[model samples]
Target: MAPMNIFDNTETAFQLKSDSELERAYFLFKMISMEPLVKIGSAVTKFALNVNLPVEGLIRSTVFDHFCGGVNERDCMGTVDRLHDVGVSSVLDFSVEGKEEDAQFDATANKVIELTLLSKNMEAMPFCVFKPTGFGRFKIYQKITENQALTENDKEEWKSIESRYDKVSKTAHASGIRLLIDAEESWMQDAADELCEKMMEKYNVDRPIVFNTLQCYRWDRLEYLKKLHQRAKAKGYKLGFKIVRGAYMEKENDRAIEKGYKSPICESKKATDDNFNEVLAYILNNLDDIELFIGTHNEYSSYLAMELMEQKGISKSDDRVWFGQLFGMSDHISFNLGAIGYNVAKYIPFGPVKDVMPYLIRRAEENTSVAGQTSRELTLLKKEKQRRKL
Candidate 1:
C-alpha cells in the first residue's frame, strides 16, 4: 500500500565510483546529464538523418556512451562481463534501425539469429530482443493491419516478413534463447502482435521461447492482454508477455489527431501506471500459464512486482519472472535489483554507431522529458564526487 522508495540506500546508490574512477565517472555523468547537450544532440541527430549525413562520432561520444553497450557485438563483450560480474544478465539487442529494403530485412533477421546463437554460447547473455520494424517495412505492416488487399509485390513482401520471423523463431528455439518481440507504433502493432502470436504458437509449446511486448499505456492493451492469454490457454501453449508503459506516446497521439480518430493512449500517466501494475499482478498470479518480463524503469512498478512475488511465495531465482531495464538510463535500478538477488538484465543494444543514431537520440530525448531523470543522474554523480573526497 505504501509507495516504494527506489533510493532506500541513498549512500550506496550515489556511490557509483571508488578511489580511482570517481572523478572521471562523475565528470562524464555530469556532462551526459546536461539538458542543453541532450537537446542539441537530439536536434542534430534528427537533422542528420533527414539530410542523410553521418552522425556516428557525435552520437557515439554522447548519448550512445550513456545508453548503448557499444557499437558491435564484439565491442559489447566487456560490458556484458562487467554486468555479469555484478550479478545481472544481458539481453543482446541488435540496434540497427531504419532499414527499408528487402536485403536489409533479410540481413537483420540473419543477424538476430546469429545473436541468438551467440547468446546461447555465452553464460551471461540470457535473452535476445528484436523490433518487428527491423525486418519489415512499416507501410507494409500498416497495410496488413488494415486488412487491405495486397498486390503481387505486397504479398511477396508479406511473405518475406513471415519468413524472417519464422527463421528467428526457429533459431531461437534451437538455441535455447528467449526472444522478445518489441511493441511498435499503434498502426503497425496489430500485425506485429499477430506475427508474434504465430511465432509463440510455433515456438513456445514446451517452453516460452518468444515473448510479445504489451504497451500498457494504450487504453486498449488490458483487454488485448486478456484475449492473448485466453488464446494461449486454448492453444495449450505458455504465453510470454513483457509489460511496459508505452514508448511512442506523442507519435501515436499525433497520428490519431491527424486522422481524426480517438487516441489509443491513456489519458494520463496515472492511468498507464495503474494498468501496468494490474497487468503485472495478472501475470504473477497466473505464473503457471504465463512467463513475464517486467520491462520498466518506474520504481513503484518494479518494487511492487517484487513484493508481489514475495507475497506469492515465489523464489527470487524464478526464471518465470524477470526484470529488465534499458542499458544506460537506470543503472541504479538494474544494479541494485541485481544486488538484491533479483533476476535482472540490462537491454544492451549494439550496432554500427551511425545505424543506431535514432535509438541514441530517443534515449537523449526521453531522459530530457522524464521528470527528475537528469537531475537524479546529476545528483548521483555529484554525490559520488564528494564521497571520493573522504
Candidate 2:
C-alpha cells in the first residue's frame, strides 16, 4: 500500500480506461486548451443546435461522455459501481438547465428527491446535489433577494418553492444522505443563500444533512463564511459549507458592467485562491462545528487542505473534510486521494446530451479561462499514457 499523502500518482486510477479512451482524452484536452477554438466551437455548436442539426452524436462522443455520469439517475449506476470498486464515491448532480415553468420545477424537485432516496442504501452513491433555480423562477429569486414585495399570486408561488426545498431536504435527512445546493450567479444568490440557510438550520440541527455552497471567488465569501459560522454558533446548528473558487465569473462581471455596479468577483485569481485557502483554514480550524467539502480542481489547494488536516491532527479519513474534483477532469487527484483512503469523490454531472449542452459549453469555457487547466489535464493524461506505453 502507498503512504497516506495525496500527491502520489496512482496508476490504478486509469486502469479501467483503454488506450483509445486515453488518446481521445488527450485530443479533447488539446482541443479545449485553444481558447479561440473553444469560443468559435461554442458559437458554432449553439448555431447548429438552433437549426436542429444532428449534433447529439458528436457531443455524446466527446465532452458529454468525458464529463457526465449518464443520461439519468438509473443510467448512472454502472458508473457508481466502477468508482466504488476503486474506493471513490460519487456526488451525483443533475445537470438539466433553463427550466422555469411550474411543472418543470416540480419535476426537477421530484428528480432530486428521488436521487436522495436512491442514495439511502447505496454506499457508492454518497450524496445528492441540485441547483435551487431548478425548483423556482430566477426572477422570483431576484425579487425576493432585493426585498421586493410580491403580489398574492407570486407569494403563493414562492411558498410552493419553499415546500419543494423542504421536501428535498427532509427526504435527505430521512434517508441519511447528505445534499449539496450548488452556487449560482450573484444577483439571485441571496435567495438561494437564504433558502439553503433555512434548510441547514432545520436539517442540520443534529447532523449535516444539507450543505450550502460558497463561491470564494466572489471576494465576499470569507466574511460570509464568518457570518454563517457565528450564526451556526448562536443558533446551535452545524454549518455545512462546500467552498469552490467559483463558476460564472464572466457572466457575473458582464452583468455588473451592464447594471453599472462593481463586479462581485475578485480582482485577481490570486485573491480568490488566497481567500479560498484562508476560508479553508478557518473551516479546518473550526472542524468541531463545520463539515466542509473542498470542491476544487486546483492541486495546490488540495495539498493545502491535506496540510491543514495534518496540522490540526485530523486523520486523512476524517469524514468532516472532503476533496472533490469534477467526474472527468481530475482523475489524478480523485484516484490518488481515494487510493490513500482519504475522503474524496468526483462531482458527477448527469443529464441528456441536448439538455446538457449549455453545461458542456460552460465546462469548455471554464477550462480555457482557468489559466492552464487544460494544459494540466493534458500533461497528466500524457504522463499516464507514456507510462502505459500507449
Q: Which stretches of candidate 2 lie over 4 Å from their true place?
A: 1-10
Each prediction's RMSD to truth: 2.6, 1.9
Best by TM-score: 2
How well does candidate 1 match the true structure in TM-score terms?
Answer: 0.92
Pull out the clashing pairs in model 2: none
Alpha-carbon RMSD, candidate 1: 2.6
State every prediction's TM-score relative to the real structure.
Answer: 0.92, 0.96
lDDT by residue (tens digit), candidate 1, 1-390 = 323665444354434334544444455556557779877766767788668787667666655666777877888898888888888899988988888999999889988998999999898988888999999999999999989888999998888999999999999999999999999998999999999999999999999999999999998987998898899999889889989887788888999999999999999888989999999999999999889999988888887988899899998889999999887656677777887788999898888777887776776666666677667766765665565567
For each candidate, the alpha-carbon lDDT, in order, equals 0.83, 0.87
